[model samples]
Target: MATDDKTTSHPADPARPGSGDKPGSRAKRAMLGAWFGFFVDLFDIYLPTVALAPAIAYFIAPDLGATGIAITGGMIFTATLIGRPIGAAIFGRFADTVGRKRATIVAMNGAGIATLLMALLPGYHQLGVASVLLFVALRLVGGIFLGGEYTAANPLAMEAAPRHKRGLYSGIINTGFPLAYAAVSLITLLLLLVMPAQGVDSAYAQWGWRIPFVIGAVLAFVLVAYYRRSVDESELFTKQKGTKTPIKTLFSGRNLSAFLQVFALMTGFWLSLQPVAAVLPTLLGADGIGMSSQATTLLLVVAYLLLAAVDVAAAVLSQRIGRRTFLVYAGAVMATVATTVYFLLVRFGPGNPRLAVVCTVLVVIVVVCPWAVLPAYINERFPTSVRASGYGLAYSLAVIVPSFYAFYQAGLGFVMPFNYTGIVLLGVGALTIVGAALAGPETKDIDFRAHADVSA
Candidate 1:
């Protein structure tokens, strides 16, 4: 499964729009548009994680115990995740065959519509169980577009980026995740002050929850407009449009191994990220750690701000050393340091808000830092023709088994405390990342237009 693409390669095509040959206004605008699209992609994805988590009872009975709520909520979250691979396949083909800019616009518009419909959805009281079903369906649909967003945008930004600056560009592009998290946190925090997600009849449970979804919808539409106006298609992609089905080519012969390796690496990332991104906020809230809603969001905002900085630093460092080497060491730290902090997090649950903040910060940083290298590493692994398709599929395909993390937590609950299960998940994820990173070639120096510099 190892990649060994070590040949002299041509530079970016000088004639194409947003070419790295002369990094100027066009590349800058394309990069910004791609980054903004990704920012909003995560904005919608995290709305369910941060914005709707507290108010999920608005769709289900509040009388359901914590475990029951977790099951139902995970089901909702998993629905979205399940749709990602499907979206990756569908939109990956579209982006590879047609164009990144167009695929991205369609995805943004579709995601916006899905999010808008979610805000308009009636609660449990209005339609009984049917309301939850409809919510899950919409989320599934939303996840498809969300999957396509990064599939197209990341490659667009990377292709537009000068090879030397790819590492920095990758890190800058990824800041969208934590920044979006912070944005969602800030918005949700303000709403909690007025909405108050306490009971089925509470203001937040009724309407305040809808505000974030509405805002998320607006963000998606705004990105659509931005992309249509400012973004440019990948010159590399335009130069070599895949005549063969990109998806089929990925699973054929040697490309299959590359796909599997990417799948493995991304699976680890998704596993490690799930707890920090989705569950941690809830754990810090009144139920698990006894903090007020406002305090929890505040702590998350601080942690995410810190994470954004670390992400950039780590990505830049990866360029200096190598992506493979960085990931191996980072995965090691995640196994020991990150998991140990998680142990501290769960052990010291309830009271001690300051210590809780520290634990959460450490865990968040340790678990997510390796992610800084992935956009560049994965993009470097595949050639221009299949870059988006391979990226989309490899990225989203891995989330399948790991998306059942809540169920795994439930099963693990028999032998240990429910909260302690996160430690195990983190440890396992670390192993996968380390093992997969070891299999890949160093990719920082690969030219975007050089097929000989990448594995099939």
Candidate 2:
């Protein structure tokens, strides 16, 4: 077998890094575990965004105007975003002190259970505003569980990865984003065809939304069980002593600077992503450009399908170049090409659905390809002791600023047409990512064990 850093395992001594003593069984399992967590994370989280968009009226008051309804629906997302950082802080320290394996398992179970319960909730007609409150609260809890999960899972995978294959592994794991999203669109589309989506008495509004929640719950459990049975603790993490207070340690000295750089990049990523990923479907449909529900979902299914291939391709390319260099280039595209695509989409999309599809695909490609390099890039930014804590917070906490994308859109309305707001938001997000990438180091080959106070 090749070196463990390649596809081989290490020498029996856990303290040692590499010797190529065994086959890459451990590395393969670690990659599978990591991929499972990320896939399940996006699958469960986006079910509401894509699947529940039409059925949102079931849980909220029907009398709210267009803006009120938009804000109320966005509130569910807002609550989830609020919970993620808290989960990151809580679970990051737990993973640092306890073990990545244990933290991941517990988080998956919590999220899965929360999703299953969402399917059983009473609608607004049954319990009035309390039903909406309960629904939002459950989503918040689900977000926390999922937030904690990737904190442990991602670091474990990166630590176990061989140096040469880190980029490939990051690509494979991040593919979950597109594939899961595509699956949600497909599932919701099929359901919409079978169930009516219009009016107060439609089957979809009453309970069709619940079906996706149930499916998401089941996927989460199956993936978690597979992860538990197949994967072990990271060979490196097992050897090191645990940090007593990783969160506090993460905030001290240079770790803080590293965290800030990651936060800035991630914040931009979230801001740029939210408009296209979450809101575009709604805008393209009955709200903005005047497409049918089926047509809108079909477009998303196609875009996400294309993205799956593009994400892997981008990852491979980033591997050939460097993570920092590729991100800088991708950010530049987001600022320029992406904005141009959005303008094209808005201007031409109303009469030309095919052009709309092409524009959406291009926008998604430029804005999201940076993610293909990020797992390796972000994981390499810190040492083992605070890896989970730092990654979790940096990845999740920055979402708060971008979580208010709606308000930013609303604010943009004062200066320009509401329909054109996404273009400005994308530009702002693009600049932030480019600036952050320029400020950070090239982490393509940083040693995981360096630059930390390792415990005895």
Candidate 3:
């Protein structure tokens, strides 16, 4: 409700109380709230990665050892992926129909509760097959909400941002993912350092893994409070709501073309980025890539920090050069370089954790830049009349397709040591580059009230 109040004023327009022309203190606050929500969402989603081994050892296999551990970890990721589409669709619709502010609050609270339940879950030893089934169910629930967090938050930030600085503002929102990853990486490193290898299995299986989830839950509550205190519903949405046109009307004609373009961009972006950035650390660490758990965790933390920094840089650059141009160039570069980076990693092995760290960081920098531009790009694609709904539908479609990526990549041998993740990366990167060139439109200096036809 408070968010709705905030959304009604156009901060940049002099005629409006919070017009776009005014200083963007309110928009900044909204961005902070959105960023915080995304931070907790990501941290909770990735918690299981650091704790996978311990969980598998305790619950999946006391005897089969590494094989059992791998299988269990795979299953969890697979289950989480399957649940993502459901979250994306359900929450996306809510954001479009009800409002972004309400949708985000619901998602954050739901995901937090789900994470807490995961922390409280019984181990397989204590509960047998039921434990695994229950864990999957909890994660599924969490994933559903998690899917909607980005869809709502990204558009909200974009809708609230000044048009001139949309690229940088959108980049700031995208940075939350890497920043949260860095935090999780640091937390995992601390856990690994504090708990000896033998103790890790028992401690994490029994309880340690739950700590991050609980922390995530607490942070979620804080974000919800922040959103309630600060964020406003988008003025764009308010003006549109006064119109008689149904939100669904946006899906017809030229708007439908715009939706398809956004969806295609997202598919290519996620397919390339998620595998390298999101899933790689877990796969590498669990596969025993020649680094100690502590070493691997440290490497991942450093890589994530680098990624965050690069994301900021990319966002700034996009504002300067233009989102479409920047994305096209970055995607092209990533596609070109990914193969070389992957080869270097395989040739050297994780024997030197530093090599893996540097290579991974490079991959992230290349991959994330294009994605960092998406919030602004998607926001600019629709007029105020159907901005949230248009963005939600298109973005969710992109996410839903890429949700099963980990399973698909594993099946393709990208998860294998010295295998073809690099090649996959290159291929996906090239497709993204081509897609960006073909579909992306320049939004710099465009007025949202004027440029209603984005596909043109």
Question: Residue by residue across 1-456, what tens digits does model 3's lDDT show?
Answer: 122322444434533312453444656766777678778777876787765445455555356566666676677877777666677667666776677788888988898888888878777678877887788788888877877777677777776666656777777777788888888777766775676436424565566666777888889888888888778876555554422342456668877777777778777776776657655565466463566556666676777677777776788788889877877777778677765676676667557766777776676667665667777878787765566566766665565566666566667774564355545745674576567556757765456645356665
Please give the CA lDDT of all the candidate structures: 0.82, 0.82, 0.68
Model 1 per-residue lDDT tens digits across residues 1-456: 223224333445545544444545556777777678778887887788778887888888647788878778777877887878888888888888898889899988999999999999998888977888999999999999888888888888888776666778788778887898899889888888766788778888788889989998998999999888777777778776764688888777667777888889888888888778757877887778888767877887888889899988999999889888999999899999998888888888666777898898899888887787788888888877788898999998888888778788999999998878878888998988999989877888776665543663
Who is ahead in TM-score, 1 or 3? 1
User: In model 3, what lDDT does residue 311 have?
Assistant: 73
Using TM-score as the yardstick, the better of models 2 and 3 is: 2
**Runs in model 3 lying further than 4 Å from the true structure:** 1-24, 61-71, 197-201, 242-251, 278-289, 348-357, 399-418
Clashing pairs in 2: 4-8, 5-162
TM-score of 1: 0.90
- What candidate 1 gets wrong by more than 4 Å, as runs, is 1-24, 61-71, 198-202, 285-289, 348-351
Ranking by TM-score: 2, 1, 3
Error of 3 at 388 (Å): 3.2
